[model samples]
Target chain A: MAIKQRKLELGVLVASLALVTSCKREDRPFQTSAPSAEAIQFTRMTDFRAGGPSISGNQPSPAMSADETPEEKEFEENAYMVGEGKRLFSAFNCVGCHAHGGGGMGPALIDDQWIYGHEPAQIFCTIIEGRPNGMPSFGGKIPSFQVWQLASYVRSLGGLVPGDAAPGRDDDMHGGPPENSAPNQKPNDSSLPKSAEMPK
Target chain B: MIAAATARWATLADNDFGVTSGEWVRGTKSVLDPAGPQSGRIHQLFLDYFWLSVVVYVLVVLFVIFAVILRRRRARWTGPILAEPAPSREKLRGWLVGLATLATTIALFFLLAGDHAAGRAIRSLSTDNALKIRVTGHQWWWEFRFEDEAPSKIFTTANEIHIPVGRTIEVELHSPDVIHSFWVPNLHGKRDMIPGHPTRIAFRADKASEYWGQCAEFCGYEHAKMRFRVVAEPEEKFNAWKAAQLQSSVQPATDSQKKGQYVFLHTTCVMCHTIQGTTAGAMMGPDLTHLASRKTIAAGSLPNKRGHLAGWISNPQTIKPGVRMPANSLPPDQLQALLDYLEILK
Candidate 1:
């Protein structure tokens, strides 16, 4: 009778230990898998359709999902997210210091002189951890997903590709005008330049 | 006693009362004469307005006193007596027409004169070369950058501006943050400095002198403390001073200086100020690259000395309340070292 009782106690102890070990395993951080071939293909299609560079793994679109319906997919691909980002950018008064993309008190976001990396994650980090020189940290003010969308809009301004976009094709996104033209040229022409020449 | 009190009040309002005895103030009197060439034009306009205002005030005061004294005792109780009203419509019309014509003429003259003066000050090309200085306004301080100099040759001074005597000095104003106004009473009027917009002001001092200036606009809580000094020196002395300011800071020779440099890097100072050629590249605050070269500290509110610098670094808020610069707590050794290092800014 005593041996049978000891065996039951041991069985109960072993079961409790096993349960604790499983719970610890569940607490481990999630490890994401590397971008798959299918993901890359889908990103490229979206980038090409959007008239941007082929998407890379570094810049995965936040809304990229294979499970979404056709209607949902159309909304993600169109100007809805970009429009939301534009509204947030103005609402937050980013243009007040940035001055319509022209550098002023703050560094120009539209220009190529990015102190932080141009990647979405990098841009998100910058907004989260504000840089020196009068920039405030908006991590608490803005939601994470909204920050990513804002980053996407800022990336789009210089006409850079989204994540999963092809590299070395930045020139294809130049829809407005060519490199050089007279200062007083018409805006509709492709020959209009980007900026005025510096004083001699 | 009442007569004596009245006499004392009258004397207190005289021009000679409470006059400053500083050398700078005396020099400014001669150099920045209200009757001088540049100021003379503006001076006349101001005088005309001043006399007009004085006359109006005197007439109003006299009328009030006369009406009070000449009032009938019975008339006080019986107000608005029943009597035949006089016809004053033609007189009223004539007065209105005369006043309108006079006001219009005065307004037109002022507008044209002001426009002409402003045009001459900003755009007129002078045969005499002007001394150019780029003045960048930060939150509560001024950064003076001289033109026609190399990167290494660049000198960053605060608050005090040094120009040669008898030369037109052109100040190109730019603001890094909010709007700031630059004004010196004896030198020139206030000019607004807008972000992304640069404005220029031109003024000349006839003699070697120092003039006081204050940020006229309500910029921030410490706006009143944001003062500057314009030091117009002899041509040769100005050149020498500029050469000295242009030179690189002397290296830290003592152990205290080395320790101060270490403290500067480890402290909050590194987060806001920049000491050029060092890792402190922060543009949020005034560049302390050549701090020792400046004549005054805390935006000209205090003299730049070892004790004041230490006090300022220790508790800036106590000296200038609501200043954006935070007061940093430091040990005695660290504060001493920092002061030692800063004293060699030239």
Candidate 2:
């Protein structure tokens, strides 16, 4: 009986060892200081048009800032960063080209039919190394963290981000309309684009 | 005369508080209260038209009230008391029509006269041998070039225009992009800077003062912040400033400054900016040859102080949202070096 108990314990150990060895290595953003010079695994622009037209995740590490909270810790899940992105968007005059997501001189961002891929990493690549047709490259100008923040904020605009991370009101401007406001869920997921309703 | 005006305007424009509150300073673009001779005429003509319109409006309202009351009384007694009527009704109708015609003619005369006077005052104020300065409107800034017969005498500057007091400074305005209007309320009324259409605005300031001018038309994102200052100083000071601006890019003396200069030339800055005597001769952005001398950087968005300059270079979009100046992220030490290099530009 004692021998059988020893054999059972040995079997359990071998099974647990196999399970540990087979554990998947997760990709995350690396934690770094502000104005982080670390290279991000940005998606290539050519691949943006291929396949799903969405970005594929590489081996990314979670870049954590010192001054982050549980609620606003992960940049992907942080609502405050989205707010910061909104501010940067206006301040940088992204509205000048993009026209508040409706696209004027630049293409519309708040749509499903993305000319570029529909991934946060892909958008980050697009911003850093701008696409052709007058998309100015912002790689050298913008810091990596802020660029990431802007990318996350942009994703929120398209309703691809988690609803909780998306802000419902602007920091100022008194809780603007739907265009400025992001709802908990996409208001037009199934509906056709409002562009069709507009006079050509 | 220029010296006295310089002191007067300097006293009025030098505000201890800051730029926003500096509007109280007389040289601001206030259309109603003009400080220059040209704007004064425009203001006076505007007031004449304004008062006449007010008087006409009041009289018209009074007459309408009188007619309403008379009509009500006439209608009440329409049965017999008033129906057979006041004899000479035909004559009364003719008299009423004549009076209306006379009132209409008088109103039309004043309207036409005010329009004619305003147009003539602006047009006929041309002076010979005037100081020539060409103001080219960019997407977000004013490029001032002092024009002279000698090609070498032409020097370009941004955001600030220094004119000699008591002299007719004839400014030729043009735009490379969309429409922009140059209006310094204290100096002259708004004039559109349409692309391919050059417009001229000549103004002579009676007193020297720092006057604020802004792009009246909405060009783009940085339109509101596209401001320029007219420094109406003494003739000697104006000439000296203009002369000094002609000097080529002076080399940096300090090691830190030299490094900054090297970094600027080697980086994306040279792609858009031009610094005289340097390889950075691109004209897409402002000329930074005399950048340190300007009162405000980023086209009058912020003071040209060290901290503001460093902050702007670090991330300009943070300060002037939507401004074309890109966010060129640099290491802290390199940024400081660039600031140090720029500070000695004067």
Candidate 3:
């Protein structure tokens, strides 16, 4: 009987040690450095399609988009970064066009449909480099680190970020449900279907 | 040690209160110094109430003392006495008590009548075309909107209120958040500004002077610092001020000013504040069209100096904690340019 009790005690100690070792380690918000361009990767329509439309205007044409970098990992996991990004979203006048992701002048960010790729790398590129019609380029204006933070926040709006890291409600008017309570949406790349018509 | 401390306190008190002259000390915002008819009526009512209470107290105390003296003189011995009370004496005491109660009731009735008369005078203005100004009370700030029939003529300003002297100024009070009370002791009594329930208060300033007004209600953080100044000026001066406020922001003349304007439009400043004739039109914050023209900034918490403005722009949290305006991380050159641009806003 004494031997059985000793075995049970040893089992409980080993189990607790495993649980502690598996606990998540969080990086402080706004403390990380910007990731290198080589770290970012994503899928473009041109890469998948046999023949696709060429990139138009002064818009940037990167190879592809959305393979999570270590810097992005830090942003999506930190709750403070998400909250700070929500504040910056208003301060940078993102709500002026997006209107809390419901889409006024710009397209809705909360919806599943992504004109560009729905990956974090793709979102970061779209903000840093201006799109065709209305989306202004904030490359030289906002710091690169802040742009990454904003991308993480945008992902949260679509219920893409982790639930624990998402922001809560604002002190102002109750516009809609908060980002944390947002339902998960599977990203659908709409650009792939219309990629066959190539521009000379 | 205690005696020494008391002696020092007595000397300090003597220095503060001891006077050779018979002149009364009147504060700049004292209710005793009536600048309008509304305050004058209130002052008179307060005086009447004060003197009436004093008279009643004195009479009661004297009557009690007189009764004690009479009873002592009429007593035969100091020990317990066996004496029958007279029916006439009891009847007289009943009559006296009834008379005192009647006098008190009459005094209260008179005060009620005075209060009603003051209320009527405060509500009813002599002229039909009183200047209408809508005051919206925020957490710790005041927004004043001067209404007009024409949209072009309508303008909004904050903190400092200017009105033409000798004219009834009608103010409609509103609150988007918690309850606040607006009180200009020199001009009018405090009136509650309840959220969702609009209230109105009318008063006319007879004197051409500046009077300070403060938030009478206990609001959230920095409530004590929530203050404004009422400038009662001549009709011509008031109109000129109004005309200047109606105009849009001026175009930048210097290179630094242009850079400053660019900084303001491009940064978080544009996200909240509005500068007329500029693309930075957002109503979430105050309208900075005529900001430089105003005497103070941050809802009259700080003087409108370049140093103060710089400190406020860099870190407003340190100066006024929990304010909605975030700290802008602008370089020295950009901050200087911003100040130059703002100064020309007048």
Candidate 4:
């Protein structure tokens, strides 16, 4: 009777141990480190409505400081690289269908005839969002930097000096300057007369 | 029994048992002999294989029957069933060996012969002597363009391909949209027209006659409508036809024809067609710059008669569903004028 009692006690102890082991195996530990502020901001921005302004109401606008040196201004002005854009343009075989400057299967990029508008931002959008007939969208195919380079190449078509052109002038043919300008600031106005702006 | 008899009678009527009439029949004096180099090679190959098959079949059947009867009679005298070693094992092995040797020889011969014939077909002709013609395949039509001419001098004709008899003609085939096959059965076998790739077929017709062919590939909704005609004429006649095609489209002589041209330009016709001299420069469809010159319409499915032409213009989709050419609901007077203008496309 004492041996029987000891055997029952041993079985119960084994069962309790097995149960505790399985419970511990199934449990998952919570993450300790917090996500970066930039990542959290990006997720919030993407959740906004379609065609909404990229910036939120709370964030302050980017500004140029008085402490900015001549070297910095020159670098900012020279930010649009014409040489890199030209290399990317030729490598992508954009000329094969466009035919040097004359249109064949695709429209002429050099001419004033803008199907989606010749502004830099608009051109960028057009490149990212392709036209229906034949042009395929390169949004995901190319990197963001490469797209900006292509936009610069197209902007050069209008006789604009490559490095001198500002980054985000909305009305200027590079897709009406960049969208992230200061709250009240308007983009650079086009010098061409209203009559001359019309495409032939 | 009645139904079977009626079916037999219909079959008999369709069969060309004996060549009673002057019209051509299979296994009779050929309308066009397969005399060209490529066709001659193919014909000889076919005959050799056919005779070989007949001889082998007869010998095998006779041998099998003779062996079976002899073996059964010999075994009959022995007890009800004598367990003997397989007697025909050696014979079966010998037969198999003989058959394999025969098959290998025939296969090797065909492989070598086919390679040689294909090589000879594609071998380039002397530049000075060879005639070069560009054949473009559309949805349900063919556009023939003769080389050695300017863009303006380029004449667009459909359905029919004109060639000079006994002269080697090299045709470069191109397809604008989907795949299409060019075939002229009596003249030459079919060659496919693949997009972005030009395929060439070289052959000479031994006889001067019109041979019929249809697009062998099911290109689209109008695959059946995509028929072609090979009009093999004498050298002098071919030259004259070429010269006539190069000439400008004749202007409308009658007031009704003038009205038709106006209707063609103003109506939906201008949206899909092109006429070289007029404002109709749209290229969504075939160039009707020289439409009347073609012997048949709707590819080669319909004769180029006024009635068929009118019917096609009224409701093309009814005849060939899914056809790119839509039905033009025109007033009677406008439709008549358009028909008149289209008839003179030559």
Q: How displaced is residue A78 in candidate 1, in Å?
A: 35
Off by over 4 Å in 2: A1-200, B1-26, B61-94
Tens-digit lDDT track for model 4 on A38-134?
A: 2222222123322343344533323222222222222122333433355456555665676544567987554455665554445555665465677
User: What does candidate 2's lDDT look like per residue over B1-346, in tens digits?
Assistant: 9999998766554432134433332335566667777788888888887887898799889989999988888778864344455579868988998998998899789878877877788777667889998999987888988999999999998998788988888889998767999988888888999998899988887777777889999997779889888888989998898888999877899999999998787656765788998887867678899987888877777777898788888777777776655677677888889888888887
Q: What is the lDDT of residue A194 in candidate 3?
A: 35
Per-residue C-alpha lDDT of model 4 across residues B264-305, encoded as one tens digit per residue: 876567756778778877665667777887766777656667
Native RMSD of candidate 2 (Å) = 17.9
Please tell me which model should have the higher TM-score, number 2 or number 4: 2
- Most accurate candidate by TM-score: 3
Looking at model 3, give its docking quality level: incorrect
Error of 4 at B139 (Å): 1.5
What tier of docking accuracy does candidate 1 attain? incorrect
Ranking 3 against 4 by TM-score, winner = 3
True contacts kept of each: 0.00, 0.04, 0.09, 0.00
For candidate 3, write residues B113-174 as lDDT tens digits.
Answer: 98898788777667567899999887678889999889889999888878999988988999
Inter-residue clash pairs, candidate 1 = A53-A166, A54-A165, A54-A166, A55-A164, A55-A165, A55-A166, A56-A164, A56-A165, A59-A163
- For model 2, what is the error of residue B51's alpha carbon versus the real structure, in angstroms, after optimal superposition? 1.9
Off by over 4 Å in 3: A1-96, A99-101, A109-133, A137-200, B1-28, B63-77, B80-88, B194-197
Indicate which candidate wins on DockQ. 3
The lDDT ranking, best first, is 3, 2, 4, 1
Docking verdict class for candidate 4:
incorrect
lDDT of 1 by residue, B1-346 (tens): 9999988655443211122122112123221244224565566556666766687678679967876765554367767644643558568858877986897688668767875775475345352577778898876888888876466666666777788887888889998667999876666667998888999888776755566667778887778778777777889999998887766556778999988887787666775677876676656567787787676788776666788789888878678775656566687988999899888776
Interface RMSD of each: 15.3, 8.7, 5.3, 21.0
